[model samples]
Target chain A: MKIVKYEDIVLKVKLACLQMTTDLPQDVQNKLEMMAMQEDGQLAKQMLDIIIENANIARQENRPMCQDTGMVVCFVKMGQNIQIEGGLLADAINEGVSLGYEEGYLRKSVVNNPIDRINTLDNTPAIIHYDIVEDDVLIIEVAAKGFGSENMSQLKMFPPAAGIAGMKEFVKQVVIDAGPNPCPPIIVGIGLGGDFEKAALLAKKAAIRNLDEVNPNEKLLALEKELEVEINNLGIGPQGFGGKTTTLKVNIEMFATHIAGLPVAVNINCHAARHIKVVL
Target chain B: MATIKLETPLTIDKIKDLHSGDQVLLSGIIYTGRDAAHKRFIEVLEKNEDLPFDVQGQVIYYVGPTPTKPNQAFGSGGPTTSYRMDAYTPPLINKGLIGMIGKGKRNDEVKAALKGHAVYFAAVGGAAALMGKCVIKAEVIAYEDLQAEAVRRLEVKDLPLIVVNDIKGNDLYVEGPQSYLKEHK
Candidate 1:
């Protein structure tokens, strides 16, 4: 069995947190540059220019890109053949988050309770999902999810008979409904065919995927292209100022579900699209 | 859209001249408030208690900026979604709050109140760092315990924004898209 120290995970997460906040991933940057070239509206293009510039400035100055630095989300893929020495994995992750947010001077955006609405101050209790795998590798995928785009996400359980057309319409409707709120030139993530909660989770993970990563399945890739086009056709554009470049990309992740249900979820990721991955 | 500049304490006459789609640069003093502070503002209004700051001819920016880093005036400060404030806006407007800076769609109530009364400006949503640089000075004037949600007085210079909604009921969120679609077609 492969053994790793607990501090290693904490250290990696801390660095990832700082990196994700200060740097806009190159894949997202390339997509924004391409979309900026394609944008038709004068104002939309101008907005994209400023966004790209802001990303550059953030990286150069070592500053957080947007004020909403986001709630931490870690996707941990644990190996069955490995054991972590020292502290609990969850606690280590939260510690790394606190250290990173505080040290990096990123915003403390987490509230302790939904209703009580008191600030957590440290931005802790990260949302974590675990998957057990057969290997010795512990893969940690971190995403800082800003609530602006997260709040615009949608989920629907349609009858099997509702078919692809209904799925398309609903996804499009969510983008339309979101408008300028989530900040357009948004990435659209669709999760199809899973059970209710699974679909929502899949949608979120899909949203965090790099824009350059196309689905391996030929059919899914084609659907992604179609959805991307349909969304851009709506003219929501950059910051919903109106143009031909509404969505940077559309990512759809699917799974098999019971015959009785057809569940779908849509998660919107703003142009920032912050995420990082580490394998140990 | 034309570019326009407006100083602080925007007057009704100046606000009347602005139609939707004009690019705006706001300079001088403004107050920052978000969901929690707005709620408190309304509660204070209800109790006939004086607001921590005067409301007349003032602009409220819907933002909760990151805490300032060393030697920096402020952290990345940008507009939050405006529609969330839709419920609390009318009361603020009734008290002569004339300008608001934010992003996203506003409801019918906000539109009705803005007509012949106030204007709404759209700051680029994710352009926080750029906007924060425009804030030359910031101080938490009230609700310190609310932390980021505190009502802070900020001195800004040429903070770029778009006149999304103005008196006479012009809404860029609605009209900007429709005009673009028609022109493209």
Candidate 2:
């Protein structure tokens, strides 16, 4: 059995939090650069330039790229043969988030309660999803998801009759309704053919998926590409100032669903796209 | 379009001259507030109490900045989504708040409130690190308990912005995209 120390997990989570918030991942950076070069509007091009420059400044100075450091979301693949020493895995991850937010000078965006609306101060109680696997290695993927885009996400349950055409229209309409709020040029993550909550979670996963990575499912891959084109054609552009580049990419994740219902979730992510992965 | 340099305490004439899609370099003092602070602002107004600061001819930046690091006036600071504050905005606008710096489209009421008196500017939303550098100074003026949501008086220099909604009721969010689509077609 592989043993992972609790403190070690904490340290790694902390570092992941700090690094992800400061550095724009290479794939996202590359995509933004490509979009900037191809963008038709002068203002859109300028906005992309500023966003690229902001990424650079944040990295060079080891500071957060955006003021909203975001609520921490962690996806963990736990090995069946692995044992965590010292504390619960969730606790360790939360500890790491608290430390990282405090040490990195990131914003404490979490409120203790939705109704009470008091700041949590340490950015704790990270949203964690766990999957048990057969290997001896533990993998943790951390994403600092900003709310500007999170608030723009939408989920809809359609009758089976709606089919692919209806799904495409709904996704397109979500982007149109979102307009500049999600901070275009944006990445769209789509979850299809799942139950309500699962679809939403899948959409969240899709949003943080590596930009350069292609979808393995052939049909979904084609759908992603087609949606990317359709959304970009909408003229939402960079910062919604209008241009040729509204969306940088569209990623779709699909799963089997019930015979009666077709559920779709669209999670929009801003250009910042902060996430990191660590294997232990 | 040539970039216009605007100073704070904006005049009606200056606001009227501005148009949607104009790039602007705004300097001078502006107050920062977001959801929580705006809520409090409305509550204070409802109680007939004075605001933490005067609203007349002033600009409020909708932002919740990260914690400031050592030797820095502010941390990465960018505009939050402006629509969340829409409910509280027209009231503030009526109270002589002449300008707002934020991201995204404001509601029709905000657009109407802006006519003849105010303007709405969109800062590049996620460009917080770049935006924070423009803030030369920052001081929490009220609602310190709100932490990042606290109202801060900030002295900024050449803070880059685009006029999204102008006093003449022009909305760049609508016009900018429409123009781009036309050109591409």
| Poorly placed runs, candidate 1 (over 4 Å) | none
The total of clashing pairs for model 2 equals 0
- Fraction of native Cα-Cα interface contacts (under 8 Å, chains A and B) also present in model 1: 0.62
Candidate 2, position A21, lDDT: 95
What pairs collide in candidate 2? none
Q: Relative to the unseen true structure, what is the C-alpha lDDT of residue A166 in candidate 1, on a scale of 0 to 100? A: 93
Q: Model 1, range B44-71, lDDT digits (tens) per residue?
A: 9999999889989999999999889999
What DockQ, between 0 and 1, does each candidate earn? 0.78, 0.94
User: TM-score for the first chain of model 1?
Assistant: 0.99
- Per-candidate Cα lDDT values, in order, are 0.90, 0.93
lDDT digits (tens) for residues A201-221 of candidate 2? 999999999998988999999
Residue-level lDDT of model 2, residues B1-185, one tens digit each, is 79999999788977788989999999999999999899999999999999999999999999999999999989999999999999999999889999999999898888888888889999999999999999999999999988999999999999999999988889999999999999999
Per-prediction TM-score: 0.99, 0.99
